[model samples]
Target: MSESEKAARLSVFKTYKLFVGGKFPRSESGRVYEVTDSKGRWLANAPQSSRKDARDAVVAARKAFAGWSGATAYNRGQILYRVAEMLEGRRDQFVREVGDAEGLSKSKAGAVVDAAIDRWVWYAGWTDKIAQIVGGANPVAGPYFNLSSPEPTGVVAILAPQESSFLGLVSVVAPVIATGNTAVVVTSEASPLPALSLGEVLATSDLPGGVVNLLSGRTAEIATPLAAHQDVNAIDLAGAEEVLAKELEIAAADNLKRVRRPQPVDWAADPGTERLTSFLETKTVWHPAGGSGSSGAAY
Candidate 1:
């Protein structure tokens, strides 16, 4: 074969890995699936991850929690913003990867990639401000003063949307982290490439280990344990399979885990600030009043 012919036919095997505790490794199952080109030609095999893999990611996120949630808001904001920079540097890769995974034309894929990166930057700006936005002072019905504020909901487990994998993943992760919640995200089962690539961007972007644990596997098998996991204070079902999403909602009821049901989003549609709402938790405080000189509700 001519050199050009040899190069043209050279098939690259895609090795998919799970990201946990800031490191990437093969799925414990040691299995992979054959991806295909638009014409249905073989591309490469990705990891056939398992429920065990999902559990492992959760453990990592749980372990990383105390430190990550404890991080200074400014520091967390800086790291979250750095993910956008990393995404920008990897734009070409995403353009190609998303095109292949979502079957989009190159230009369309690039546009989506650009939007996803921008979304991360948008959320990074929220890290320091989200708390102030969702929370405020309230008039007391009694002799005491009261204030309500937002707090992190502890470790969050997410099932990211599948269609617009990159941006959907960003939507889920950004809001969760904006309120100081660390997360364990399940890679889209049929399309896990962009999600894993995102993990690399996040890791290199100075995200603390376990701040975002990514597992590639069957979404249902993995997410069930998480919704029921007592330690997981919240579960973002924004990407759950139909039966699975319903099941998790029921399972979440067991522990009263704050469940966010999946909503079909038109990625091309403008997402208002409403996406920033769920991650917030209300903590209302009351203080005793003595003098009339006391503050006005004390924010």
Candidate 2:
């Protein structure tokens, strides 16, 4: 090809931005940092999120929580299933991004992408059934009936795992939304492209805006404000280093936020109900039993 034809063949680069309030916005700080492949090759620039960005995410999540949590369990299941469908259609793109992010061979990356998609499906199936598994009637004396129900714990901030970017991210995030809680996710600092790309898929899916917010930046810088934010009800430090997790845990204590500390995880293993149950709060109601004509007091 001649130089003129070659110039016309130049590829258009993509600008990676934070997914906040279901919209792609540059960081409030208007700062960006270099994102490189695992081999140190320049890839793209990702927005370096700031404390203000973190707060914005919390506001978005909080705004989305009531509607999301109020939706029927079956409806949440349908939306999560839709997410899986969208991911399946974009399988190839995720395979490429995961491969570059983790320095994996194409075949290995394909397996990870498959696992992530399947993880979404797995969580989708649990949406309607989780309450049954965790909640039920309780045995009580004195002609009183008691029952327990699981409720969403409002806004949850999740730190996506550093190494297993796609699969680990899916693991932490899918369960949160599937169970009717909105999330503010901090993607893998070193490998955030896949997570950011996933945001596009979510936007197109039927999920409400702000149900899942994605932030790409220095993990510690973004996590600090989220951990301390009064609006955030829970935090999952899945990607934090030991010291950082401990510090964030302490910060979360200020408002008695539910904390899930970082732990060594096998992303390929079948994730049990632990993640689903972590962000749930059990609400038990007691009612006095009486005849149909009698007034019954409930508490």
- TM-score for each predicted model, relative to the true structure: 0.89, 0.95
The clash count of every prediction, one per candidate, is 0, 0
Model 1 agreement with the true structure over 1-299: per-residue lDDT tens digits: 89989889966655767788899878788877766645666656666667677777778888888888789888988988888999999999988888888889999999999998888888888878866777877887776778888778888888888666787888778878867888888877777788888888888988888889888767777788888887788888888878888989998888788888887788666676676677667889998765455555533
- Model 2 lDDT vs. the true structure? 0.94
Could you give candidate 2's per-residue lDDT for residues 1-299 as a string of tens digits? 99899989969998988998999999999999999999999899999999999999999999999999999999999999999999999999999999999999999999999999998999999999998999999998666688999999989999999999899999999999988999999999999999999999999999999999999999999999999998899999999999999999999999999999999999999999899999999999998765544454443
Cα error of candidate 1 at position 152, Å: 1.0
Q: Best TM-score goes to which candidate? A: 2
Model 1 stretches with alpha carbons more than 4 Å out: 1-14, 37-39, 141-143, 292-299
lDDT, each prediction: 0.81, 0.94
